[model samples]
Target: MAAILKDVMSPNPVSSNATDELTTVSKKMKEEDVGFIPVKEDDKYAGVVTDRDIVVNGLAKGSAENVQASDVMTENIVTGPPDMEVEEAARLMQEHQIKRLLVMEDKEVKGVATLGDLGVENAVETAGNVIHDVSKGNGNN
Candidate 1:
């Protein structure tokens, strides 16, 4: 039996605008209790903003209010499809060194898949390897 991304991904993930203030995005992240948020521009998926990007790029620039999601968002994001195999998704995460992957359908944002989601599906080893690789700067660190 092949487990698909839609079976384990967090659907309809919280998102933000690329032009939004970093402070606003940070607040949303805090409120959502999430470390990452999808970024959109012109109603189209643009990139991803992570807590690290906030600290490293946003704060480093002086004020969060002065920073925009586009200023800190990772534009070259690796996305996956809803029907993708879990193992393949895990592999993509490992390859990208990213902890989360935006699940897209027809070029539209659909959901997100995290290493923890894989762990929840009993892919502990895969999740661990992903974490290790991402932590070691292999994914996007």
Candidate 2:
């Protein structure tokens, strides 16, 4: 049987308000020791802010203190159901050129699945393919 997303997802992911300043969000990322933070609005997941987004979008825009999490967050994020097969999730991540997928249920964010998590489950080949694809022309090399 194929492994499900929930079996490898990082549950109860850290989230931040959309209105939060980049400075605050950056601090939260450091405190949580995470590279990504889901952005919330009206008690629902809105988007995701990553360390790269902070540096590229927030810093490049100047005055990061005035930048909001929503300003740097990736709005059109890819997501998956908790019951999705790990292989399916890997396919989605590769198709979307992303490293993580938000696990959602009934429009509620439950957890996040990353390439590292897939590796932990011994899906190294799939994870490697995803990394290679996502890194293409993205300066990840």
Candidate 3:
């Protein structure tokens, strides 16, 4: 049987509100020691904010204090179910050229799967391929 995401993913990932200021999101990132954060809106999982988003969209634009999480969050983020196979999730990450995969269930953010997770889970080959492809920057950024 294939390893599922729940086995390797970090559960109950930290999240932020869409209406939250970028400063708030940055603090959350710092407190959680995570670069990625799921975003919520209207009590629903809406999007994601990353450290890069804060730098590129928030800081690069204007005062980060004035920017909301929604202002820098990636709305069309790719997601997968907690039960998804590790190999399948790796493929998805390679295809999307993204480093992280937001694990979702019942429209709620369950956890996050990352290349490092794959490596830690003994999916080193898959993790290597994903890292290589994502570094190529071929997918939509």
Candidate 4:
């Protein structure tokens, strides 16, 4: 049987509220040592705020102190089920040009699967392909 997302995903990722200030979320990211955070609205999964989102959308737009997670979060996020095959998850990440894949089950956020997670699962080649594909057209980054 193939490995599933649940077998390699980082479970119970720390989350932030849509109303949270960028400063607060940045602090949380520092504390957790993670660049990504799932954002919640009304206790429901709403979007995601990444370190890039903070710099590109939050800091680049206005005073960082006044910015909220929702102000910079990446909505229309890509998501997958925990039971999804790891290869499928890699394909999904590549297809979306995203480094992280939200794991959802029954309309609830369950975990997050990252390229590093896939690499650690012995899918290094697959992870590398995702990185290459995502970097394409991303431009000078």
Candidate 5:
């Protein structure tokens, strides 16, 4: 069976508003252990804010903490519906050089998918080699 984006997506990812303060956004990102957050404006997904963006743009530029999330988010985003095939997602991710994707259903936020979520474990000390190991019938990593 073809894998679906839902299988790899992180449901209900931590998100924030474009108008929210940078401090608030930082706290949410850190507390959630997420590198990115979906940004919304006028009740619609506006863009995404990434940890790198903060470091490169906000901190390096010395943007005040009072600055809004909108000021730092990357607006040019690529999104996919929940039922989108994993290959399509992978293709998109490869084409865009993105590690994550937002999953939507009926234009409503549903989940998020990241490359890490799709990776198989590599530990080799147990009764068997880790996931996706060739000996156990899982696909090669």
Candidate 6:
């Protein structure tokens, strides 16, 4: 199977505005069962924020409710086109040690892809032997 951004990217991923507070972002992440959310500016991609970012940059600094998502968002995002293969994306992610990738198409944000979303569906090996064994009924080995 060819790896493409469309096959992995989470379409319509949960998002927050740049002006949103860190506390608010945390709530959204919990409510949506997501570890991160994209930051947007009037429908334009701005940056991205993860749970760790909120904790380290906000709560750790005692500024959760006051800190804006933009302030702590990861601006040096490694994005990809929708047509890119999933294997290539995985390689990039591994080299950078990133868990998620912002998907872009025609210079616009289309979705986001986390390591789990891509490999889990295409190759169980992408998740390691633990997941593979679990999914395969833990055969007597």
Using TM-score as the measure, the top candidate is 1
Per candidate, the number of residue pairs that clash is 2, 0, 0, 0, 0, 3
Instruction: Tell me the whole-model lDDT of each prediction, alpha carbons only.
Output: 0.84, 0.82, 0.84, 0.84, 0.72, 0.75
Model 6 ranges with Cα > 4 A deviation: 120-141
Q: Estimate each model's TM-score.
A: 0.88, 0.86, 0.87, 0.87, 0.79, 0.79
Ranking by lDDT: 1, 3, 4, 2, 6, 5
- Over 1-141, each residue of candidate 1 has an lDDT whose tens digit, in order, gives 988999999999899999999889999999999988999999998889988888877898888877899999988888889999888887777667677888999988899888778654556776677678766657652
* Candidate 3 ranges beyond 4 A from true positions: 120-141
Instruction: Residues 1-141, candidate 4: write the lDDT tens digits.
Output: 988999989999999999999999999999999988999999899999988788878899867998899999988888999999988887777667778899999878899998778664555765666557645644111
Question: lDDT by residue for model 5 over 1-141, one digit each (tens)?
Answer: 978888878999878998987788889988999878998899998888877667656787676576788988888877888888887776665455565777888778888886555442321222132322423433211
| RMSD score of candidate 2 (Å) | 2.9
**Which residue pairs clash within candidate 6?**
3-85, 3-86, 4-86
Per-candidate alpha-carbon RMSD to the true structure: 2.1, 2.9, 2.7, 3.0, 8.7, 7.8
Residues 34-64, model 6: lDDT tens digits? 8778898777888888886776666787767
Q: Judged by TM-score relative to the true structure, which candidate is superior, 2 or 3? A: 3
Worst lDDT run of 10 residues, candidate 5, spans 123-132
| Candidate 2 residue lDDT tens string, 47-133 | 899888888778998779789999889887889999999888877776776778889999988999987776545567756665677
lDDT (0-100) at residue 99 of candidate 4?
Answer: 80
